[model samples]
Target: MLRGFYGAGAGMITQQRHSEMLNNNLANAQTPGYKGDNASIRSFPEMLMQAENVGAAPGGRNELIGSMNTGTYMQERTPNFAQGDTRQTENNTDMAIVQGDVPVNEEGNSGALFFNVANEDGDLRYTRNGSFAVDGEGFLTTAQGNYVLDDAGDEIFVNNEEFTVDAGGNVFDDDGEELATIDISFAAAPEDLVKEGDGLLAVPEDEDALPTAIGDDDINYDINQGFVEESNVDLMRTMSDMMESMRIFEANQTVLQAYDQSMERAVNDVGRLQ
Candidate 1:
């Protein structure tokens, strides 16, 4: 009887979390370079049930009932690293990476690419967002003001917004003189990267920094100026998922209510003395 209540409560909590994830994806549907997350739900281990205080049956063993499931929970959320569609922003500072051949890891997952940036703390970070801006100090920066790094891991000084970036990721001034090359980092398993807010990704503390994708003979990619990669979230699918999650939540709530009513009866009516 108590297990019923616990199972229903766990189900509600799991659905609530799943709904939150779906809502977040829907909200970020238009965010540039955003990746959607998938929830991994798992059930608790089953417990073997047996008759209590039962004498030895035919084979001198206690009577066996069955296995009872404990409950379920949302285990983890994994980000989908699929490429988003590119839209032309018609801004010189905007850039979009068109990834081509990339090396696959032993897990059979293709690698991903990201632009290297440095936050205010001078810590290295990464992002797929290419909507860059030239600050007052002639340094290239992301929308959130992170300094965009070049191939040498130094802040790129593009001089002004008029700088043009070629398909090779080389920045050139109005006179076509190359200034610097944008640093693109490669992750053999991007799912391991932790999501920091504002479109930033960080490598785990135990892992080393990602390697540069540039000069890699096997990797092929091209940068397109005047464009940005849109978020990979699917609007209709997210809406459908949100609805399903809500329905599940409602069902769990109903089950919990039923369990509560049964408990009330057991405490009041069943325990009542003649």
Candidate 2:
């Protein structure tokens, strides 16, 4: 009877954390390049549960399992690394990288872009969103204000000169000569792909940062200019998850309340008489 109360307490704390995760995912459902987060409760250890809280007899010793712990045993953020859908915005700066042959490797990167995107010591910083433009300094920037890179694998710096990025991710000056090219790719390993703030992703590590899955002989990524990657989250699917989470939370609450009531009556009516 006493064990029921403690068990319920554990559940209440776990449910609270689950609800928080659901709310956050729903809020960011429309965010571009955004990944969803998940939460889960740690299952009760069966061995511990089999032990008696007060020894085998009445009022012996309180075991760890019997102690009421109104604490959360839930994981706060389990990041969802699933890919988002790509939507074509048709903007010149908006670019989409699909699986294809790698043309120009790299030249450098530009400082003005979004998602804090920047080159990592000559290595290319990766992203799913291609929406970008050349800033006053002739540096390419994303819609949210971060630098875009050039082929030398450095931040592109044009110093206010007008330029165009061709279908091959090449940057051209007003005279039509190639100044530099964008160094983007989709060949990063699953472990190598990492998240930057606000839908931007950074290379998982600086060492061995080049695309290994692409094979070392030559570059193998094709660029689709004028298209942007779409968000991977589905509204209908998220809503279903939300409902399931809520239902489980309510069930936990019910069990906890029943336990509390039972414990109260046991202590007041029987314990008081003893």
How close is every model to the real structure, measured as TM-score?
0.95, 0.68
Best by lDDT: 1
- Return the TM-score for candidate 1, rounded to 2 decimals: 0.95
Local accuracy by lDDT, each model: 0.91, 0.59
- Predicted candidate 1 versus true structure: per-residue lDDT over 95-177, tens digit per residue: 98888989999989889999999988999999999998989999999998999999999999977648888888999998898
Model 1, global lDDT: 0.91
Model 2, which residues run further than 4 Å from truth? 38-42, 48-78, 100-116, 119-126, 158-167, 185-196, 202-220, 270-274
Q: Candidate 1: how many backbone clashes?
A: 0
Candidate 1: segments with Cα more than 4 A from true spot:
55-61
Model 2 Cα lDDT, one tens digit per residue, 15-37: 66776777777787766665676
Candidate that would win on TM-score = 1
RMSD for all candidates, in order, please.
1.9, 7.6
